[model samples]
Target chain A: MPELKTKLKEYRAIFDMKQGELAELVGVRRETIIRLEKGQYVPSLKLAMDIAAVFGTTVEELFSFE
Target chain B: MKKKNNYRNFHIITIIVVTVVMLLYFIGNIFPDNKWLTPVIIFVYLSSTTKLIGPYEKKDELTKINLGRANGITLITVIAALFVISLIGSNSDNKDIFASEVYIFTALAAILMRSLLFIVFDRTPESLGGDE
Candidate 1:
């Protein structure tokens, strides 16, 4: 099953947040953020929700199944 | 999010604590400084290493899969290690009581299985995880 990822800069640009800022808000390491952007680590449901909450969006809007 | 963060933080803390305690143990052993402190240091070392599950793995049952793959791997490795140890010791009449393998097969198996479990079964239910 392929999990659709957040677009490279969509959430970040929406919040005017840097990668490090997003990582800190989501309670993951900056390296995790880097890897996640490069399609390495798939964010967990909790992390997905947290990120969506940060940008005032829903999890469904942030991620999709491909 | 914070829960996951604490898991990573706890792992770092454990590594630091174990490293310091082990260093102290070696220093105590070599220097022969305090007879009172050596046993205490050894106890700390054992306690820290035995705490493999930590708080996160304990919560996620799949990571605690000693009943399946981990246990099988551990059992086979231990049997093999014991065989090798016995073979080596039996070669001579005088048995070396303190002989050991630092990275014994059992230890290797445990680490590998633990890491595999952590990566693949990290959040999945045990019903859908591991090898028996």
Candidate 2:
């Protein structure tokens, strides 16, 4: 199975958004964001879009499949 | 913040109460003379409330999905266990135990499994909402 590599931490830092802040924006728990950034869990389409939108980037820019 | 504290407090209370009930069941079985204990156990089972274990309306999608998976696993386990239990009960000469008791035990096991899985996979309440 291909794994998704996220640049979430970098983009989030660039946007000055804490994990909790981003999670709230995406309507999910902070732990979900943590798991996503750690590549331990995958997000749904809606969640991926929500997260990307929060960082003002496209999902392709935020995450790469490897 | 207070709500989160209350939720944690509720969970602690639930664990303590469930532990006591299980201990009573164990002791009652070991020392059969405790007729009074049987009634107590029945009362505890009958009056049991699932305030801490009931489904929540506010769980996030990830948490909900994890919970669903946990329930599916628990259900499969219960079905497999009941098949084995039925076989054993039929083979054993002891007929003292009723089918209802077996069903109750199965239900309790399922609930316990679900609760354990939920606690293991779930994050702190603080992570679910507004930041501190």
Candidate 3:
């Protein structure tokens, strides 16, 4: 099975953003952001788009299936 | 965040209230005569109190998904438990546990299980043990 890998933590670091701040920006719980960073949760298209937008990147840039 | 806190607090309060009421009923301190009345009162109280909490709490996508998962698991577990309890009750000559009590216990257990599972899912990161 292909796993969803994310560059969420790297992107957050580049933006100097905390998990809570990113979650607030993307309208999700901090835990959701944490899970995304760890590749434990597969986000919906809208949430993926929202997070990617927050980092000023495309979803394909932030997330990949491996 | 305030809305989220309120939603969580509301569920915690409901669990505590139900547990106490059920305990009192089981101990023969309240509703000793009318067994069905206890569940009816609990159901009415829960429904009425839910309206008081308002419907304004907007859950995020992850929270909503976790809740759905938790509810599904809780339902399955409760049904399985009830089946096992009935099977044992039918096999044994012990008549200590009444059907109404079993129903009340099952409802309480289901509520507790769903709430606890939601809390766990909401708070715990799934990859906590993984290499960071």
CAPRI-wise, candidate 3 is acceptable
Clashing pairs in 3: none
Chain A TM-scores, per candidate, are 0.80, 0.92, 0.97
The residue-by-residue lDDT of candidate 1 on A1-66, one tens digit each, is 686565636777767778768766776645455555655456777877887888888988877667
Error of 2 at A44 (Å): 0.5
> TM-scores of all models?
0.44, 0.73, 0.71
* Whole-model lDDT values for every prediction: 0.54, 0.68, 0.76
Q: What is candidate 2's CA lDDT for residue B108?
A: 62
Per-residue CA lDDT of model 2 for A1-28, tens digit only, reads: 9998999888877887888778767877
For model 3, how does the per-residue alpha-carbon lDDT over A24-48 read when each residue is reduced to its tens digit? 7888767677788778889999999
- Per-candidate RMSD, Å: 10.1, 5.3, 4.7
| DockQ, each predicted model | 0.04, 0.25, 0.39
Chain B TM-score of model 2, please?
A: 0.59
Clashing pairs in 1: none
Which pairs of residues clash in candidate 2, taking residues 3 or more apart in a chain or in different chains? none
Best by lDDT: 3
Highest-scoring model, TM-score: 2
